[model samples]
Target: MLTRLKDSTPKTLLLGGAALFSVFPLLSMLSAALQPQGSSPAGFSIPTNPQWHNFVDAWDVANITTLMKSSIILVVGVVPVAVLIASMAAYAIAQLRIPFGKVFFLLLLLGLTLPYEIVVVPLYYEMQSLGLLNTRLGLILPLIGLNMPFAVFWMRTHFMSVPAELSESSAIDGAGPWQAFRRIQLPLAIPAIASLAVLMFLSTWNQFLLAIVLIDDPNKRTMAGALQGFVGAHSTDVVLLNAGALLIMAPTILVFLAFQRYFIQAMLAGAVKG
Candidate 1:
């Protein structure tokens, strides 16, 4: 028992220190947020009179309600469709033994290495040609495509980890490919799918550059993208800015908190192993 405790002591301390380090920025932001709306707060200093109303003021100033609606629309459009398509493609590649499966997977691996920035210029022209620019679908379509390679890769890893014998047994029992995938494989892949959904939600919700470039209207942009306009108008007010930033971040934080267990389980299970 003593030896075990000694062995774990360094790791425990290291994790604790890392947690504190990670949390410091949030603590500082909260401190600044609680300051009087126009005040420039010194680093990590607590206000004598906390302006708790800063959040409310910031919300109204930023018109966060409309931004939240826009972000929700983007999330709804992107996450489900993206996850479903990626999972199905992954199942086909990993289990169905489709023609040129390895070659297709290699293409997806290449996609994973491609920088998002490299495609932006071409995507802009493509959207322009398709009359998709300055529209919500404009952002929605690109985000789904941008997320595919990683999502397919992740789900493929999970499907590959599943025993081939189980698939064979299901086929022996007269289940077709779709039935086996829907009933057996899909249920088992919930943890990985949930983790991927959370990641997609985060990426879509916080999308900034594409949102700004593709959508001219700020009201149609994600919360993080809308922040650019809010900052432009209220650049001098640090307190309200921090409050607005935190408010924008609240949903993604809440989502991760809710699904963290499943996310951690998928990670521990080597969700990326192939």
Candidate 2:
């Protein structure tokens, strides 16, 4: 016991220090939010009189309700469709070994390396050509396509990890491919699906560049994009900026807390295994 404790002492201290280091920025932001709106304090100093209403004022001034609604709409539009399509594609490639499966999967892997900047111009032209610019469907469809490479890759890895016997058993019971995927595979892959949903939600919620470029209206952008709009308008108000940031961040944090166990499982099971 003594030897173990001694060995663990440095590791514990290291982890504690890292935790404090990671937390300092959050503490500083929270502290800044409590200060008077117009004042910009340099570091980690607490205010003598905390201006708690800054949050309330920030919400009203920023029209955060509208911004949140826009974000929610995008999340609902993108996440389910992306997850469903990706899950089905992964199921086909991983289990059924669709013809040219390796080539298709390789193309998606190549997409992982394609930067947004490289395709933004062409994407703009395509959206414009399809008369989709500035519309929610415009943003929704592109996000689903952009997310597919990673989502399909992640789900495919998870599906490949599942045992082949499940399919064989279903076959013995006279289940078709669609039936096997819907009944047996979907239930067995809940953890992977939940983890993918969390990731898609986070990415879609925080999407900024596409929002600014694709959607013209400030009212129609994601929360993070709306925050950028908020910043441009309220650059001089430090406290309001921080308050709005925290408000925008709350949903993603709640989602992560809810499905964190599944997220850890997904990571361990090679969600990003290229």
Candidate 3:
């Protein structure tokens, strides 16, 4: 017991240090954000007179309301469609045994290996040719495609873990492929689907590179992308900048915090099943 405790002590200390390292930047940002709007905060000193209204001023300056709406619209467009397609494709590949399923799965795996930057140039040209440049659909479509590889892989892992006997039983009970998928597999896949949706929502909400490149108008870009304009305009003001960054980060943080337990459960389930 003493030896076990000693081993755990080192691991616990290491994790504690890592946690502090991760949290240090957020603490510093909070410190800076609470300072007087134009003041430069040194290190991580907390403000004696916290300017809580700095966040309000930053919100107005950043035009966060409009950006939030744009991000919501993008998320609405991308998440459902992406999740639906990925779930169906995964089910087919893992359960239905579609022709050339292995080949298709291999293609998706290849997609995961490629960097997003590699496709940006060609995507730009394609969007221009399609007259989709600077449009919300332009960003939405590419994001869905970009999300597909990992999304499919994640759902596939969950589907593959489901016992084949369940599928066979459903088929014997007069259930068609779609019926079995909807009734048996989908119900069982709720945890995975919910986690995937949360992840996709976060990805869509925080999308930066594609949001900026595909949509030239800052108004139509994701919140993170809109930060480019906010930063450019208020680069000199550290307080407002940090406040704005925190505000932009708040939704994803809140969302993950809310769903973290379920997400962890689903991830553990996948790990054990896989």
Best by TM-score: 1
TM-score of each: 0.96, 0.94, 0.94
Q: Which of the two candidates, 1 or 3, achieves a greater TM-score against the reference?
A: 1
RMSD of each: 1.6, 2.3, 1.8
User: Candidate 3, which segments miss by more than 4 Å at Cα?
Assistant: 1-11
Q: lDDT of model 1 at residue 8?
A: 100
Where is the poorest 10-residue window by lDDT in model 3?
265-274
Please give, for residues 192-257, the per-residue lDDT of candidate 3 as tens digits: 888999999999999888877888788998999657878999989999999999999999989888
Q: What's the ranking of the predictions by lDDT, best on top?
A: 1, 3, 2
Candidate 2 lDDT for residue 13: 100
Tell me the lDDT of candidate 1.
0.93
The model with the greater lDDT, 1 or 2, is 1
lDDT of 1 by residue, 46-148 (tens): 7788899999989988989999999999999999999999999999999999999999999988999978789999999999999999999988999999999
lDDT of 2 by residue, 1-274 (tens): 9999999999999999998998798788889999987898789988899999998988887888998999999999999999999999999999999999989999999999998778788889999999999998999999999999999999998999888999999999999999999999999789899999999999999998888899899899888875777788899988999998888888998999999999787777664544
